[model samples]
Every structure is written in structure tokens, then in C-alpha cells.
Target chain A: MTKHKIRKLPLFTLIFFLLLFMAGVISGEPSRVLEQSRQICLSCIGIG
Target chain B: MELARKWVQIVIGFLTNGYWAFPFTRTIYQGPLKVVCSPGLNCYSCPASTTYCPIGAIQQLIAGIRFNLGLGQYYLGWYVLGCIGVVGGFLGRMVCGWACPFGFVQEIIHKIPGPKFKIPRILRYVKYIILSVMVILLPLLAVNEFDMGDPWFCKYVCPAGTLEAGLPMLVIQPDLRAAIGHLFFNKLAILIFFVVWSIMASRPFCRVACPLGAFYALFSRVRLVRLRLNREKCTDCGACHQVCPMGVKFNESPNDAECITCMACMERACKYGAISLEVGGLPLHSSPLRKTTKS
Candidate 1:
């Protein structure tokens, strides 16, 4: 492994996930999470 | 440094669960911050939780993947996935060590005077199985008549949910108490078991059962912010191993997957200045005070 190679891997992984995060925003996923979270998640609390 | 970590834990715990008015209102936070992914395991349904648990959010999204795909909606939980991946890749299990509200709770419980015990090595694999089976596979595969599935891990398994959401919610809402039956007792029993176990063992949940811990462990090798061991300085004295609450041997394997990057090795254990916390090949915190007191 070269010096640049060590840096390259993490840089690429960060870029990929950052892009994925941006894509998620474009897909309106946060709204869904928000909507579900706003509801008192009965199952999450183990009551359901 | 440990004091700084403790303050970070406390501040983050408060900031993440920052709806401090929950006790008076007896209501859950339904604000805009609910959309943000909590890096820690603070319960989404907790009365004061300003941010949502990534695990619960992901499970809920995954549980509806098939149903959404069927309707051409395409709910891949990309935001949650990206959020987790970025954090894991960057910090590994630092979140577990420093920010996790539940882990903090366990650490506090472990402070109780008792003979501490190491978790069995075989049990470490159980967290991976739980992550794959309960968090992903079950939620994605086990759909009902409506083509929707359950957040199996949070619903059935996570004691964090039981402690943070169940008991507190029950206390807040008296009418909801009537709905509790076998499930509540089952979960309560699980919570009690872990609470007692933690008193004698450090983070048994993180060691053996936390799916998020399992996920982050995968990134331990590649995490940018990580520990580096200067073997030349190490004496193989076993000081780091004895001091590790998570039982990682720093001299032998600095990047051990189970390592939470708690820096106990860097801060308190390595009297020889062998271990250092680094970010992208640059040392950020290193060179601990030499031990005058015995380990």
C-alpha cells in the first residue's frame, strides 16, 4: 500500500456516503422519518 | 481527557435528548429536530428525545421497503444509511464510547461496586447476527397482509427502547399502562437483566448485543479517526489490556473491531506513550501522563 492509497480509501468512502446522504434528501426520506418519529411510535416503545 | 469525554457524553446526551420540558408536559418532542438522525441510541419515542435513533428510523424504513417498492415509492432509507456509514467510516465506535446515551447509562451502572467480568469472545459474534437478522433481514422479509413488517430489533429486542421509551412513556401516560401485558413484562425483564449484568460487567449490551455497535465495528479497520500504536515504545507490559473496559489489547491490535476508541488506552493505560489517537495519519491526542499510581 502506498501513502496516497491509504488516504484514497477513506476519501472515496466519505464521498460515496456523502453523495448517498444528498440523494436521500432529494428522495424526500427525511419527511418520512420525521412523520414516523412525530407519531408516538407505539411498537418502538414495546407497547404494541 | 476522561473528564472531557464525560462532559461530552453528558452534553451530547442532553443535546440529543434536549426536549427538557418533557417532565412538565408529559409529551414527546414533535419538533423539526426529530428529522435529524441521532448518532447515538437515544430512543426516538423518549419524551425528551430531540433527535431520532438511527436504528429505529432505519428499521421503520426497512420494514416498509417491500411495501414501498410495490407501490413504486422506493423507500430505501438512504438518509439513515448514509448517516450511519459516514459516522462509522469517520469515528468507528467513538459514538458508542462517548456519545451513546444508553452506553453512558451502562457505564454509570458499571460504576456500581462489583467484581467486573470480561465478556466471552464468542458472544461478540452475536451482535453481528442480531444486526443482520433482526435489524435488516427480518424487517425486510417478514411482512404481513399489508406487505409491511415490524422493527423487530427495536420492537422485540432493544432494551434501550424499553428503558428510554417504554417505562417512561407508561409513567407519563397512565391510560397506555392498561395496554401493557406480556410484551412489556418480557421487555422489562430483559432491561432488568441487562441493568444487573452491567453492574458487574462493562457494556455487556455493546459487547454482545448492540446492532449499531456491530455495524460500526465493521468500520473499525478503515475508520479515519483511529488509534495508532507505536510498537517501539510499547513494552508488551499488558497495561493497556488490563485498563481496557472493552478488553482490547492495544499493543497487539490497535484497530480491533471491538475497540470503541474510548481512548482509555491512550489516556490512562499506556504509561510508555505507545498509543495515540490519530486522524488521517496526523496525531491529535497522544503522550499520556506517566503512571505514578498502579493500574
Candidate 2:
């Protein structure tokens, strides 16, 4: 690709991911992450 | 700018870990804010952590993808990946320099005067491998009898988890000590090893082993906001090389993957002011010495 196109890619990627992120939120992924993280995270603490 | 950067890191450190009532409550903060993702690597399991670590959340989602799909769930952590992509696309590794609590801890540990060593350049690729295998592939593909996969990176590795979550949790609840075994010892050893190594080398973990860093690096070539270098103004004095904590040779490669946008070179090293923080081709902070020179 051209230099200009390459430069524009991150912005495009950002918008795309932002939309994807909103989709994730609508799908209740954040709630799931919240639920998992709210606990003691047994494996993270190295106990599980 | 170094002093200013230090203060910023310290403030962000506290802001991200704002749940100080963990000691009084004897548990992590489980408020509604937990759904939001912090840009840097702050362990959610850390009692004071108010936000989720992007890497950890990604691994958790990926690990459970198969099981979740079986249960007819459709989400695949688009939010987490989007969070990562947004930051990485905008600022590259600047988050490590100015926001990461774990990176601040590493910098603090490295402050103690000691003999320093250079990390092997080849080792820079290791984080990418870890990101691919340990963080993504293993969590997605490695399954148990129940068809559920573990967050392998958190389970077997991740010294940050040991420092931010494992040790603190153990301190908070002594009852957890009973379950401690080889895993705890292994993680402890890893943490201690990184602590000592950080003193010897600047950001050994960030440079070599951080999967999050690896992921952000993908956007290095295209990050919208970053430190820009003017080859015309640069004398190629190799000054940026000497001052750079991450060993980035800014002259040779302006937007190197490992360049954390720390501005060490621009702050104190370069006198000509060839480097400046920029966004969308506009100068945000330009040459301190020669700001008057027309661009």
C-alpha cells in the first residue's frame, strides 16, 4: 500500500474496533468480564 | 519532562488503583466501574484495582470461547480487543511510559543503583510468542475434560499477577496460604527474578515478556498519536540511544515497536529538538530548544 494508506490504517482499525467494542458491550461481554473479575480470581492469585 | 513524566506515572498509578478500601473491606473492589478496562496492565485481582487488565480479560474470554459457544453465547471479547486496539492504534506503547502501574513499579525497582545489562535484541520477539501462544492460542485451544481451557498465561506465568494479585491476596486473606503450592512458589520466583532483573535492565518485562506490549506493538506502524522524529533536524548524534530507557534507537527507526514514547531522548538527550510529540500530523509538543523554527 501507499504511505498515506498505511498511515490511515490505524484510524480505520480504531473505528472498526470501536464498533466491535460497542458490539461486545451490547452482547453483555463486559458484564461477564465484570463477574469474572469481581471474585477472588483464584488462578490469578495462584491458588487455583 | 522526566520529572513531569514521573509525577504523571505516580498519579496514574493511584488513579487506576483507587479502591483503597480493599484493606478495610478485606476484598477487591466490585463496583460497577469494574466493567471498564484500564489501558495498561493493572491486575483486576489486585485489591485496589478499579479497572480490568486488558490482557487478563482477553485471555479469560478466549479461554471460555469454546464452552461459551457450546452454551449458545455469541460474544468473543470484541469489547476487550477494541479497547486494546483503540489505545494501541492511538498511542502505541505510550501507555507503558505514562500509565502502567506495573511499569512504574519496574522503573522504581530499577532506580536502585546497580550494574546494568543490555537485553538481547532477539528476545524482543518473545512477547509476541507469549501473546500468541500463552495468551491467545493456549487459552483458546488447550482444553480439559470439561472442555474448558485455563488462562494459561495467568496460571503458569505472569509475574505481574504474582506481584499485584497473588502476594496481596495472600496478605489480605491468610486462609489462602493453605492452597499455596508449587504454583505460588513458581510465580513468586518469577516475580522476584523480574524484580532483580529490572534493577539490572530497564523494563526487561515490558521489552521481553509482556504479551500486552506485543499486542500494542502491532499498531506501532500506524499509531495516530506518537513521538515524531525530524530526520532533517536530527544530527544523528546517537544521544537518543544513550538516554532511551527501552534502548530504542529513535534515529534509525522513528516508530519502533519497542519505543514506549517515553520522550527520554527528547526530554534530556537531544539538544537540537528533533523529536516532538505529534498527533494527526500536528505538533502537540515541539522542540523545546528550537520551537520557533518553522516546520
Regions of candidate 1 where Cα sits further than 4 Å from its true position: A1-6, B289-295
Q: Write the per-residue lDDT of candidate 2 for residues B1-295, one digit (tens) a residue.
A: 8888889998988877999998888889999888888888888899999888898889889988988999998659898998888888788898889888889899999999999999988999999999999999998899987668888888888888888889888889888888899998998998899999999999999999999888888888788888888877888878789988888999999889999988888887777879988776667786567444433
Could you tell me the lDDT of residue B24 within candidate 2? 82
Candidate 2 regions exceeding 4 Å error are A1-7, B290-295
lDDT of 1 at B136: 97
- Model 1 Cα lDDT, one tens digit per residue, B39-131: 888889999899989999999999998888898876798999899889987988988999899999999999999887888888999999999
lDDT agreement with native, every candidate? 0.87, 0.86
Local error of candidate 1 at B228, Å? Answer: 0.5
